[model samples]
Target: MSFRKRSEVVNTRGPGLQNARGPTQDSIQNARGIPANTRGMPVNARSPVPARGPQLNTSRGRNVPSLNNNNPSFRGRLSQRMSNMNINDDSNSHLNNHPGIRPSPATSQLTTSTGCNDLDSLLGHMGLPLGNSLLIEEIGTTDFNSVLCKLFASQGIIHNRLKNGNSQQESNTHVIVLSLNKMWGKELPGTYKGSKKDIKKQNIANEQSKISVSNLNEQSSTPSRYKDLKIAWRYGLKDEIGQKNSKSTNQDSTEYKDYNHQFDITSRLIPTPTSDEITYIPTNIPVSSILTQLTNAIDKNPTKLIRIIIPSLMHPSMYSPNYFKLTEIIPLLHGIKSIIKQNESRCVLLASCFTNLLQSSISSSKLLLNQIQSIFDSIVLLEPFQQEMIQLLEKSYKTQPNKIQHGLIHILKLPAFSEKGEMCVSRSEYAFRNGRKNFEIEEWGIPVEDVEEDENKDNNVDSSASNIGNPNNKPKKSTKVDLEF
Candidate 1:
């Protein structure tokens, strides 16, 4: 309210210039050398200068000190209240109001959006909808890395969707996945990046290409900065009531439809993710690593869904830390079974054991019989021969190693067990070319076998007089009935 006086205004005391009109034309004429009116008046007065009028309510008006100058007196009050309570700039306050940009629905984790749907179905909602940590199990493939990407990306998706406002959609959802298995190159969508994905989406500025969960090469600190499912769901649901839905959906749902029906694949996990960001593990992944992942998931949330897939080619030794002892692995698997039955979340498991390792390794006796069956949502056992196969394997290893080699490395070209169903490379062939690294298709399918060679010679010998009483065989019903001495 108070204004400081400048020296000229306060101290000037020029005799002729004292404000009674400093030297008008008449006075100027009297002055001896008054430069002949210099065209007639002081330049400023003749120009478009403003005239003095009503003085503003400030100290400058009176050039005097008073209580009202700095502070209002008790008797005097403000004539008009402050017009508006506002500052000249607002950028800082706006940012302060929203401390976080991408607020997670739960725990306030930050995340980007992924533009795909095929990836989100298996993983819960985007932004990782809290509550349960998914224990993913890949089946019929090496796309586990891709699946995990989607899993992590779901966190981003859920985060943005639930809390970021539905009108300004998310462009990409990035997933941070840990992989113990080398993933197929084609699994990740070719155009994978940060903001680049945002441009790919149409219209929705926030749409960050549907879930590009980052793939960290090195594991970061333990407390992952992400939201759990419940919070993610709330965030993802925010604008979804009226926003555009994702274009991509499950492409391979059918493959897993059979998986759900036959291979113990999770109902929600069906139609595995075909696109997403991921890190791939490339060597013979130790079975220990897979168990560790499941254990970690369990440690985080025992009630979350769990899934597992194992290749038939894995040898007993591949499960080394536990010494490939079916005994040890079977117990662990049995434990999973008990847990699944007791929880709200689901558990699904798949393996070539349906052919190579089932009875031999998974169920040597009746011990794990019920536990193994109940643990998996469904079990697709594809033994080419419906009858017992170990006897046939024993015969092949003996009579004709050539037949074993011919049926496997040659005719079938897949080195699995004698069931003649699973045709995967055996892990023991570590010394061979490429060894037991990424999955190799050369070990699965074979051209239909010639009936003569494919027949169970062991059964044939047993059916004939030569095999009637072998220890592995039993007496015929006719023999027991015809004992009418």
Candidate 2:
């Protein structure tokens, strides 16, 4: 069966998965919507038989939680179950029995006009709940943005298919891009524009991939960085600073170092002086008009899985100000969550922090943590693993086993199903709620013990400079000389 190409056309019949997953996994669909294209959700079909596994027989001698920590009676039963099932890393325990995971009364599937049955299977139910937010907070950048974009794209695809009165299985899903950094052009959340540079700069072989760097400073007042006025203003600022203040000590030097001056792009954003020089967008944004297009998409796809990924490649500080906390991003986030629900798709909202944030002192109103939290259904702080926290997740799941029932099938579901199929994966998915409340950075500066001398030196230097400027021709001598030297 033929499908509509990118130009857009409607077709009433054919197999959907065959196109994306190659001809093998393809299943034919008649006049109705078909299955396939299920990138985000999990396949819940009860396998008629256990899938084959290698002969490592790795199931035996499982580290089974220690007796000290695990209740003996429960542990005996749990151990017996584990022995019977023999869960390994490769094998999924869905086929096995569990006393804890009971089906919800609302477990029925939501039917869609879209022909894709796989989408439903992957999503468990047809859609995500209203106000449900999936936050993936991690330090590493691997596959983070890509996976998120796909999730958002998949959601949008389903929504569009339903909107068209056709099955998503039967039609093509298009998540128009609003703006971004590092997205592949193939599908979901649309294409990724490497950098927002002009065509000339884009041609440069070594031009930095925007996603590789992170911006720490994103302004709240402005919308688009590429705007002409913003760019011009930024250029002027840089020129002025280079000439006059390059050697001068900055008042906020402490704050700058707190972020480690992360311009090297190891884990954060690069600072851009003006809005227009936002030559890179690590978000893989599909559209050129970053700000306006994103706002528009948010308005359009409340029920779709729309991802506005501000990758860690950009300077965190550079982008944070324009992020949800800075502007009216609440409406956009609400729209995003709403659209996913309306369209019967799930939404994943991921925000990455840069070195700037780490470098900055912890202060109220700066992180805007609470405001950002309200935008999401759940939050995950993906950083280095802590053993105590892991233990907590395990304990919580044992007592409240049903907490992550739907999560069992979701691949990225935090605290995923333990390797054994028993509830083991710690869904510290709500990382913020479960995360450390007080995380601070320590850096030695001029200790307070030496503060008096330093202050005296600073005052003396300032006074001398003032005197140098007042010799009748102070404007010429102290006129902030544009040091040609």
Candidate 3:
């Protein structure tokens, strides 16, 4: 009986003891796994975790704000600095009100007229862009390029007159001529009046209109008067006529401040510009001194658009032989470029040079010419027709003298101030004629005589082809007999 009782005592702690012992062992193991720093913490408590930096949203994949905002990183600081700086503030706003300046048709950059509409068109931007320089080079000794310079100067004067409106105190444009010519103002060309034919037609029309008006009073009661006054309502002619009248009025209002104007080369500009409007710089001075004078002129007229015309650049009569050296001329041009870039919104430069003066066959001379051209934003080369070529053109255009071209114009470079900086340097088939009323540039074609000769050759070819199948037009038999085969 004692042995049976000892076996039954072990069975009391089977399921319940095991369940309680399992939890106690787990608690001890967890306590041992924790570090010494967290030994006294509650069993169910968690350790503190550090806050994270900026993160991307999982759903949208966009940047999320940083948890800490006290000290921003370098990138954040840089972004803040950039947003504070406004570089182009009001730079172009002032240019909009300038009467001489207008938006370029191709690039929308503010452009000023070259005084010659045809020359402006040749620049490819419809006008010379502000802050640009144009270099006109003539191959011969002829002073044809001077006409363009005068036109340019005249345009500036006209624009200044329009902008100031009889107020001599305030000037809108300042023309600085680097020459000793004191009577430069007197040489500027005049605005073109209508040609003789056009004037005659206008006078005849005026007289006819007056006659018709006087006759209208007598015919007012006649049925024919009513018939003449009848409106073409079926074709909406009344609306078209009204629109045309309104358009004419609008054109008249805007024509006074036209960007380009027709000029008569034979006549002088009326009401020549005052001394205050134009300044002549003595070219006999040192190049540095000349630059200083230009800078001073620009500084004095800060509010006005400055047109710097350096006519006959490095001419023996205008500039000393020392000034023709590369060391001297390069710095002068560089200084001018610097000025233009500094006052990029308000300044333009135009210079003309005779290439024959610089012997381009030599490397040094060629290098000098290239350097000069490189400084300018646009370069045009004038090759006047030779005497024989002129004679040929005269002969071909005997019936229409105006159609003959005096010279060929080559565009070496185009103005490139736009955002795209696009430029074209190609052999353009363009010819220019200095007309009485206007400087004309047109597409060049062969002479009419050559065209006629080509036509005759084509006719000969046609006749030869026609004779291919004709018996009467066949080739004649050989006079000498061929060798026996």
Identify the candidate with maximal lDDT.
Answer: 3
The candidate 3 region of ten consecutive residues with least summed lDDT is 23-32
TM-score of 2: 0.28
Per-prediction TM-score to the true structure, in the order listed: 0.24, 0.28, 0.66
lDDT of each: 0.33, 0.36, 0.80
lDDT of 3 by residue, 1-485 (tens): 35575224334467678666563323444433554444578977755545579745567766655556564775687679889998664645655667778877677888899998888878877789999999999988688999999999999887877634454534578999999888878899988878889888778656645757665764565533233344554345555567788986566237535677888999998888887799989989887888898899888876788899999888888777777688888998898899899998999999999999876434488888888888888999888988998999988888888898988898888887323465566454888889888888888887856576778799688768778867788754446775767
Name the lDDT of candidate 1: 0.33
Q: Give the TM-score of candidate 1.
A: 0.24
Worst-scoring 10-residue span by lDDT in model 1: 431-440
- State the lDDT of candidate 2 residue by residue for 296-355, as single tens digits: 554443333333344442344344444434344455545545554553332233444432
Best-performing candidate as measured by TM-score: 3
**RMSD, one per candidate, in order:** 30.2, 33.3, 12.7
Candidate 1 contains a number of clashing pairs equal to 56
Give the residue spans of candidate 1 off by over 4 A.
1-293, 298-317, 321-326, 341-343, 346-354, 357-371, 374-377, 383-485
